[model samples]
Target: MTGSLISPRVDYASDPARSRGRFQIEPESRTRTPFQRDRDRIIHASAFRRLKMKTQVFVAHEGDHFRTRLTHSLEVAQIARSVARTLGLDEDLAEALALAHDLGHPPFGHAGEDQLDECMEAFGGFDHNAQTLRVVTRLEQRYPTFDGLNLTFETLEGLIKHNGPVLKNGKRMQDLPQAFLDFEHLEQLDLDTYAGPEAQVAALSDDIAYNNHDIDDGLSAGLFTIEDIKDVPLVGRIFHQVQKDYPLLDRQRVISEAVRRLIGVWIEDLTAETSRRAKRLNPKSVEDVRNLNEPLVAFSEKLDAEQKELRRFLMERMYRHYKVNRKRSQAKRILKELFGLFLSEPDTLPPPWNETAQQMTKDARARVVCDYIAGMTDNYAIDEHRRLFNLDAMI
Candidate 1:
């Protein structure tokens, strides 16, 4: 794969020069394409900066070596760029989607998200994907001219619909998040269709990165041993090959080598599979890719089955392990306490948040509080809970 040359640019690859333009028009950059500017803006946003301390799988304070949201985003960008480059897609757009993917993930990984969803049930449910749309469209608050990063239509479309169209079978989505509804009122994302091919590549790149990295984290945390995972499908085969090739290799090296190979194999398979699909679909333009019913980017059936098996292994062995469950329980408590306190006693919230909460209606007030908590880092959430609830710590 390293020696393979980039294919000639395809008509279906997103063209930055021909971008649909930002919501708020400005002078074109002398040095950057529209997508490049979008990527740069996201990299500099406060939400992007906060991802450094946000939990990926393990809480940030759990260990120095664990993958935080920031590191995970970077890894996803690398994989996305490689896939984009190999397929003659726009590398910058793929990288942008990869980097911006998790900007809306709350403090303690899925645990925080789950708690937030329950707390907001009265107002509107919370979803990280919808929150990501909110972050870019309205939450970032950097520019004097715009409330959020005024990105191109392509970027916005990709970010919101990266998981395919929001609608199911030509019906309007039931219970769409308030943020998504708000954005659609402003500028419709055509949520009935799949995102362009670049977005599809970025989404698959996320799956590739998380699956492999979670294994590394789980092993390091002693949740499961390397030997315990040797019976899993695709991963198990990679491990066996690595061990047989390097009989005396240390455990750490064995895991690393096997994971590296696993990522490579997946990338190779994805590139081949996507190309095959493109040939059959004969998409005339980027729009044609979106209009198609099937996803342009996908894994082969065999690999997809194997990947599902790996997910099951991780779910039972790592996600449901007692240690992780305990952490998740504590995380839920902190978020619930914070949400309840902030809503009941809006004055307790800090200066601007207090003022902001005071000015909103009930549902809006809850949404504001939700945003504040969702933006917190794992340690910040713990510290904030301590400040609010622990007398000794407050003292």
Candidate 2:
């Protein structure tokens, strides 16, 4: 109800008052903006609750301290709010996008997604972004009048196109995911253009959160040492600075300070670069932002290169560490086996899902199976696999 105290809303920011409105019109909220209402709905969604047990980079049961999807989303939302406030964008919209961005990710992180996609290859393949749209649009069945939360059009558009346009230069992309196509039939998402400025902020905020948090997780896991990353461009320099600043600081504190500083550097660069772009482009409205050839929110050229270097370091030293690969291998096996068994025996699925799969054709049944599997948490998937595959285990 209170207006943003940080700064006035910018001309290019998405305005909830002037929102394009939800697909299924509902009475307006007296206490919250449409964007804020969308954020609240996402927070209360069952899919969002399941994120608590979903993997980020580590399995849920791997360690109590490791970040899960829920914590990661929270972090992303925090960063998004901060960045949006600084940039005078709609903080609620940015925060909502951040919270909902990863709802489509399956259990066991990218490993689970990869295995599911492989299993679904004959059934149009799986894509997380498309699945995210499906989750918000068709999968979630909370509303009595609609399947999804009936989020604002702006929120839906941002959710799908946050990374950028789905279509290339007003042209349909080859091998486009079925979920996106399905949604497009119901609502035109302007798939050929970048999303609004708030969505752009949320997208970059996601990048900032994961990049920094993974460093912390990797360090905690001992996949690599601070010394190992001491040469990784901006990351390395920040760590070195932290060490120099506090010679007696413990390892954890040093990592905490370094990661904090690194995130700050990224936020500053993103804010400055975005402001520079806005000044140059002088977008008069959020529509102008969407129609721009390039994204309004971005890291400086120098920082973008450095961030890529950091990603490369993480890819080699952390994500692909032998220990992580072992987990990935096991996760892939569990998901792949689960997909195979469920597709082969729809009766294996629980209750309504089984009934739904039984009514559909093979391709449609495969998608049903995929959805059931994709909705699982890491532990749930593992347990489900055990229940199905282990003859001695009770069903």
TM-scores for candidates 1 onward, in order: 0.98, 0.97
Instruction: Give the Cα-based TM-score of candidate 1 against the true structure.
Output: 0.98
Model 2, 253-294: lDDT tens per residue? 999999999899999999999999999999999999999989
For model 1, how does the per-residue alpha-carbon lDDT over 113-170 read when each residue is reduced to its tens digit? 9999999998888999999989998899999888889988988899988788887666
Clashing pairs in 2: none
Clashes of each: 0, 0
lDDT of 2: 0.90
Where model 1 places Cα greater than 4 Å from the true spot, the runs are 1-4, 170-174, 184-187
Model 1's alpha-carbon lDDT is 0.91
lDDT of all predictions: 0.91, 0.90
Error of 2 at 212 (Å): 0.6
Cα lDDT, model 2, residue 44: 98
Q: Candidate 1 — which pairs collide?
A: none
lDDT of 1 at 96: 94
